[model samples]
Target: MTLSFFQKFWSVLANDIMAVISSFFHLGQLLTAINHTFISLIPKIPNPSLVSHYRPISLCNTLYKQILDNVMIAHDYLHFLNGKHKGNNRLMAIKLDMSKAYDKIE
Candidate 1:
């Protein structure tokens, strides 16, 4: 096995991530530092010109991502938002959590 495989299988990383995720549920808290993500824009094809031709992806630490994914799965937010509505009019819903919005300002 490679070093990375050994590290992942034997290290305390899994425990640490579970602890963080547990705190998120029991205490309703998340680390502010982990919320910051680096967004990178990659071109879909060579010699692309338009903004739509680029795909944007968020990059974060693997541990942070795993915790976030767990939380999302528990909440099932995407499943609710993606459900079809039977109507001629468009249905829309917006969720805004501004608990620490001001802290994001420079």
Candidate 2:
């Protein structure tokens, strides 16, 4: 049976929608299966292996230094806010004006 143009179009659209819905359902089932598998495996495993094996001592030291510096800066800012640098009234009145707010003249 030959389908009219509109009928063919509707049929194609319906098929595409069904395909998307089926794939979405399949994805949900896949996620559920994965969760179940992980849950079942957790208790049976004696030792869990760490997948991320990159451990650099020098990198760690650098990160520690950066964290320390940031903490010190934050502490200094807190101290300043709490009247530690209240005598520097000139620094407080310094106005910073953005040249181009949002317009780029160039």
Candidate 3:
């Protein structure tokens, strides 16, 4: 059965399982930078000229993130909410310290 344009879009977004997070370029484009995030240098202190006094701000597309975020929120709520995991034996989590991680990388 053939699906309409809106129907296809709805299905794609509603059932987005995050299988493919990739993007491609169209004709005549040498490179496609759709996932390129906007980086901004933000000052940590009031005012300073030192490079170490600033932090990098990453701004990316939120449209796709919201889809994954909704799924994660639901999963976490079911696993951690009030009395949700009372009988669970163990809890597992991974924490990554991103603070100052990009300072010397650049």
Candidate 4:
């Protein structure tokens, strides 16, 4: 039995949604880790000058890393789906022509 176009589309959409949700959960864990690390550093830093400058930089680095990691994971997921479907030889062709299809009279 073969699935119809709508079926295939829905299946792919579900997979994509699951991937995104998983990514979000991973990001949340990463944020928690970063927060914990920052909290741990708070007591060690005796000088206010050092804490003020370094905290922002550390948070920025953590954010940048998470964004980059999520993007790469999404890219890989897309590539994996593309490769999975590449083996199936399928062609979809559509042609639409609208000539004198609408008329208005006043």
Worst 10 residues of 4 by lDDT: 55-64
On a 0 to 100 scale, what is the lDDT of residue 15 in model 3? 47
Q: Write down the lDDT of every candidate, Cα atoms only.
A: 0.65, 0.43, 0.54, 0.46
lDDT of 2 by residue, 4-55 (tens): 4325677666776467557768875322331221111222234546533322
Look at candidate 1 and tell me the lDDT of residue 4: 60
Clashes of 4: 0
The alpha-carbon RMSD values of the candidates against the true structure, listed in the order shown, are 11.5, 22.3, 11.6, 24.0
Over 4 Å off in model 4, which ranges? 1-65, 86-106
Q: CA lDDT of 44 in candidate 4?
A: 33
Residues 67-106 of candidate 1 have per-residue lDDT tens digits of: 5566677468656656745676555656666545422211
TM-score, one value per model: 0.39, 0.20, 0.36, 0.24
The candidate maximizing lDDT is: 1
lDDT of 3 by residue, 1-106 (tens): 1124335676666444232243222233323343567777888899868998988866654443355676688688656754544575655555555554555222
Estimate candidate 3's alpha-carbon lDDT, on a 0 to 1 scale. Answer: 0.54
Where does candidate 3 have its weakest 10-residue lDDT segment?
17-26
Return the lDDT, model 2, position 21: 51
